[model samples]
Target: MDRLGDTYRWKSENVSTAEVAETLGHFSGIHEANVYGVQVPGHEGRAGCAALSLDDGARKDFDWKGLAAFAYQKLPRYAVPVFVRVLGTEVGSAASHNNKQDKVKFGAEGIDPGMKGKKVVGGEGDEVWWIPPKGIGM
Candidate 1:
């Protein structure tokens, strides 16, 4: 079974995916947001990750740092997503049979970049964005 459910532990804190998703949904350009936790090698617990579906015309104008800043204001530091997966479309890329996000699949994929990640979705639009510790300056 998938270790990650509605919540996951990170840095001795249990983060609520629903809360983070709600925070992300309010962002300007995101049409939808799927939040989950991925087990990071060498870490005691999982790290938060979000798979985003962008709104029309927002893809070209998406601001990464802006998103980071927005998240910083809206969420707790431990609750903020450490990784982001920009899904290709809002329709069928990562949806489950019930038309919701397939967290099981995303959880399995984790945060591997390069060819490994590309192989999971089989699409060129799946871009992985990382927020290294204190990398965003905000």
Candidate 2:
């Protein structure tokens, strides 16, 4: 996991999701942008290539393709994120030393106006999707 952690550190320090999306948006002029990765089932190793979001980053109004292509281009074949989980609202459990802990059982479940496109990012019960590269254009 050292390499994975290294990559994460590099990404967090040198490139960010928003920055990547913004760059993709500037070049593509698309409405939505995001990057995700899929973890291999039964494997504790690194995740597979990322799944890009092709939607505008706006809630209730977005282009999911924009998110997809941006990720496809910036990430090597393997480092792309796997999920396009939308956070209806950002929550913070605790932040210390500039690091924030994950908030368990967080989502739009039972919460109105927050379930649309809701996805669990990382956890035991997280659902994985295999989105075909049908519409995203590089």
Candidate 3:
């Protein structure tokens, strides 16, 4: 693990979650972002996932397609988050007591709807967006 222990392996590439989060934070309407890795069934390594908090009143106007494009341009193919979780307004939902984003629970939750609960994100109406892997069907 690196200094932040935010590094993970995906597609035989070492991905730095902080780097991906920083790239995501640069996007408009994003207030804060946290990147982590989630296990994909039958996959060799963990897959990238990001949990983001948008600026006030930015949710309805957020452009997912545009974000995808921005990510593709700024990040490497393997570093781009495969799943995005739009978190709620509550601060505790995305941050911990020390004000640092926590990834333990989020990583465990992954992108599976069935794994989601009151503790995990992706509740009713909470947008969990996903981008298919390269050359894969939508």
- Predicted candidate 3 versus true structure: per-residue lDDT over 10-63, tens digit per residue: 999999988999999999999888888998899988989888889999988988
lDDT of 1 by residue, 1-82 (tens): 4344688899999999889998999999999998989988999999999988999889998988888988888888899899
Q: lDDT of each model, Cα atoms only? A: 0.80, 0.36, 0.79
Model 1: lDDT to the true structure: 0.80
User: Which stretches in model 3 have alpha-carbon errors above 4 Å?
Assistant: 1-5, 90-92, 121-125, 133-138
Error of 1 at 70 (Å): 1.1
Candidates 2 and 3 compared by lDDT, better number: 3
lDDT by residue (tens digit), candidate 2, 1-138: 221222222233333343444455454424333332223446444332222223345545554565566556765434455444443333221112355322222222212223323433332222234434534443
TM-score of each: 0.84, 0.41, 0.84
Task: Order candidates by lDDT, high to low.
Answer: 1, 3, 2
The C-alpha stretches of model 2 lying farther than 4 A from their native spots are: 1-39, 42-44, 48-57, 91-138
Top lDDT: which candidate number? 1
